[model samples]
Target: MPLLKVLRPTLPILVGASIMLTLGMGLRQSLGIFLQPLTRDIGISVSDFTLAVAVQNLAWGFLQPMAGALTVRYGFRPVMMIGSVFNVIGLALMAMAHGLTSIIIGGGILIGIALACTASAIAMSVSARAVPATVRSTVLGMVSAAGSLGSLLAAPIGQVLSEDYGWRAGLAGFVVLSILMIPAAWYAGRVDRVPLPKTSGDEIGNTSAGVAVKAAFSNASFLVMTCAYMVCGMQLVFLTTHLPSYLAICGMDPMLSAQTLGVIGGFNVLGSLFFGWAGGRWNKLMLLGMIYVSRSLILAWYFMLPPTPASTLLFGALMGFLWLGVGPLVAGAVAEMFGLRWQAMIQGLAFMSHQLGSFLGAYGGGLIYDALGSYTMAWRIGVALGLAFGIIQIAFALIRPLSPPPVLKAA
Candidate 1:
């Protein structure tokens, strides 16, 4: 069937999913723009601020499985709608923050909880459930590509507002953008009505969540992918949380950081589309390994060179292309490896590892920077670990192809 023909009926659901994802992720990713000003104005150190971000990742990581499980019990609407409200409250708290306590509560805890309900894992699940398997990967890429637009818009807007008005004003702008998520989540919640497809393995969807968890853990391929996902989280979070400070420390123009992030968002569109398409036809895990390897190489290249506008923007483009491409591949792989019924919960298991790495990236980079007055050690460690794991991921994926999805004994 033609792509449009397949999507036309479900257009509203996909669009809502995309918008919810875009705003949720874009705003979160762009939060790094406020780090310097927020910390300075609040009389906190860089590490203190990043500690909140690290906490956010930890909260988001740990809570994701619970949220996914809730979606199974209640529905995506209630989970996502409540998250949208949390997003508003969180951003409002960040805007009015007087101290680290407020920042951690609003930005760290609230936003983290919001993300559990609203971001990539849930968004991809919604998209996967709404579309047919034949074009599932391709559609996931499209949704992810749309999601990339958030950072592109959010970064520039927040930066301009912060530069002219103040950091509070920038967060306020984000709050306004976040309000749109409520309705998006509602529309996206419609997926709850879409029945799971009956297939030979339809019984897989009927398994208890506990049974599903056991099955997922027993799969070796799933385990390797989960481990490798940690490295992915580490590298990406380090950049989002630290890249601005790195550029500023180099005496580059302040706007340059936002611009670089925007460039990343723009290029992310192309990368997401390409990877999404590529995933359907190729081995998804191998593609993931390749993205990791490419990202590490790119990180090494950019960090090694002296700062320049052209170099920074080019670096953003390269990195952006590799960025959210992970969304489609990971989500699609999980759905294929398991089944859609528990897809969100299972994927959340892997994301917990990713978020652990994110915690390390955000907080760890700040610690290194505060101690050494440079990102030299941080980037080196990131590059080294990324390469090692990327290679391992590739090798394991090739040697041990994914076994068939687990089958529970007759009850």
Candidate 2:
């Protein structure tokens, strides 16, 4: 009854938001499948191709807050619709690209802007505002799970398209699929019109955008959360951008590599949902700490064990389950601490930190491999950072939430 009550009002918005997230994140995750083909065809080195993806990650971070601010000002509809258009354009350009410049322009700049508009940060912000506080984490987690679903479906489709028809055709197919987000964007924006509950302190209705942003940045919990989120981005991007190639180097079949990624996506659905539910009842910070610790352990075990199909799938499943599990908890914590007044903007700032990590992870993996002629060092670095971030999050659990800032008086 409680779940039904929460779902009644928010279901439509959640579905719409999830669809947008699914398309955006799904396409992004499938990019790893293209690396070898794209590089071989373009006659560029792996490092050069990955640099463009790294630039895309940087551009996404740089533009996220700006996109969030725009969504705050103009509402989610226009921002998401415009972003969907950019997605089509970006994919189309990438399909036609033959050089680094075009790849950077299309994949890095355009698609980066598109992701800022359409990714989980914006979706979670909208969902947080639409749902009752009781079900907020569940809704956020479900949206994250939906994104994993996208990756699950897209991975195989992308692999098939790329292998059979060339990477260009695969990208073009994504362009067609991206058009569906236009209507979802329109429906998702409708939630913005929903009235906010009147609550004391920093409820969505009580605070202005400027005040909320200021308060969020000034809060120690948010800053620590943002730092930990950066590590999440690093791990995620590095794996998504390079995992297939890494598997290839380890003597795995290409099809098996794609299948492994798909398996990761599949398991992530359960992981996100479980973490989302757990976030409601458990210590969110501790849960985040565990997720990072799990990642480090998984990576360590992966390298320690022999590289084989069964072992690879097991690793993929473990990693997938932990992959985006941190997302809902982080978003839920932000909403709990800051309220939903400018949730999109504040969450965007946190996601910007994530994207910054993504830039380094995606680009740095390529750089390390190019110089060292192996990805072993990069994997080692991921293990170290994961352990460090896990400790940082546990330390953060000791800090109390900051008191809300004083409301300014009129002259």
* Tens digits of per-residue lDDT for model 1, 93-205: 99999999999999999999999999999999999999899999999999999999999999999999999999999999999999999999999999999987643334568
Task: State the RMSD for candidate 2.
Answer: 2.2
Per residue, candidate 2 scores C-alpha lDDT tens digits across 1-411 of: 978776887778888998998888888888888899999998888888788888888888878878878876788888988988898888888889988888888888998989989887788888888887878888788888987887787888888888899988888888888888888888888887987643223454455677677777777777877888888888889989998898888888888778988999899899999999999888788789889988988998887766899999998899999988887998888777766766677788888889888988899999999999988888898889989988888877766542333331210
TM-score of each: 0.98, 0.95
The backbone clash count of each candidate, in order, is: 0, 0
Report lDDT (Cα) of residue 190, candidate 2.
86
- lDDT of candidate 2 vs native? 0.83
In model 1, the clashing pairs are none
C-alpha lDDT score of every prediction, in listed order? 0.92, 0.83
Candidate 1 stretches greater than 4 Å from native:
199-202, 406-411
What is the number of residue pairs that collide in model 1? 0
